[model samples]
Target: MWTASAVLPGAGPADWRELRRDGEAAEFHAATEMLELHGAETEAYLHGLTAEIPSLYVIMRETAGECPLEIVQITASPYEAQDYTDSGEEIVEKVPMPHGLVAWVRDFVEEFHQDEIFVKRKRDKKRIDIVEDGVGDPRIDKAADIYASPSLKRRRLQ
Candidate 1:
């Protein structure tokens, strides 16, 4: 999987530039691709930003066209990035998050993030431990050893 060396911001449409080629190895620079942030995914964005080394995920897909690879997605949310990794058909790379992009994400998170409150569930007072009503087959009428197998019960009767 190829990693993005850098991100170049642009005001116009997206385009690519050939960097260099060494026979079989070649590099291209893709520009003007925008990374969008959603309010609903603020939690995922927060998890990514708080990591030890915050990063941007680049997902590339292999194509049969003239271009060998195509950029599928560029994501700031690690959770979203993880989804692409599971497919095994796409290439996922971790690129160090740019300072400006990090700040932008932080601003978006600050505006949309909401803390969820935890609620503990209370157990009902039903006394289920006192009885073993369904432990044995209903066909057997014995009360003392309900756990005994049907064969054992038949043997005891004989």
Candidate 2:
């Protein structure tokens, strides 16, 4: 990968203390050295490149309480988690497994729905008192012209 001609090139043998090489090889070595210098950045970039596709990872994080939870990582997953009890918040249970994950989630959701308290939506109960008057006459009084405005009479263009 690294070449000696790159390290020492056509510059000259004048400076014996320091080695001089071809500028092209030096440039190549410099590029490699620059890449190596940002090892962490390069690794992160490569990781991001590989992470273009959606993946599921169970991330365990310490929460307010003393228990660790499985935080699901997904770009997009149709699974929804719901928790309502002495425990605090809902947890993500959706993760790519061999199988039966959907059934487990469905059972969990069913149990949760059975035990969870759902407050009934309060109806507005608004009173709409529509008073009807005597509306017998369907005939309309109109001007000689149909397009005449109430404020300004229709202008006649000759």
Task: Choose the strongest candidate by TM-score.
Answer: 1
Tens-digit lDDT track of model 2 for 2-52 = 221222122333322333457543322211111011222332223322343
RMSD for each of the candidates? 6.5, 23.1
Candidate 1 wrongly placed segments (more than 4 Å): 11-16, 21-25, 130-158
| Global local distance difference test of model 2 | 0.31
lDDT per residue (tens digit) for residues 1-158 in model 1: 45566565444654456778899776777545679889999999999999998888888887888766788878899999899989898888888888888899999999999988989999999998798565677656777657766654344554
Go through the candidates in order and give each one's C-alpha lDDT: 0.80, 0.31
Supply candidate 1's per-residue lDDT for 24: 79
Error of 1 at 44 (Å): 1.5
The TM-score between candidate 1 and the true structure equals 0.71
Stretches of candidate 2 off by over 4 Å are: 1-72, 75-98, 115-127, 130-158
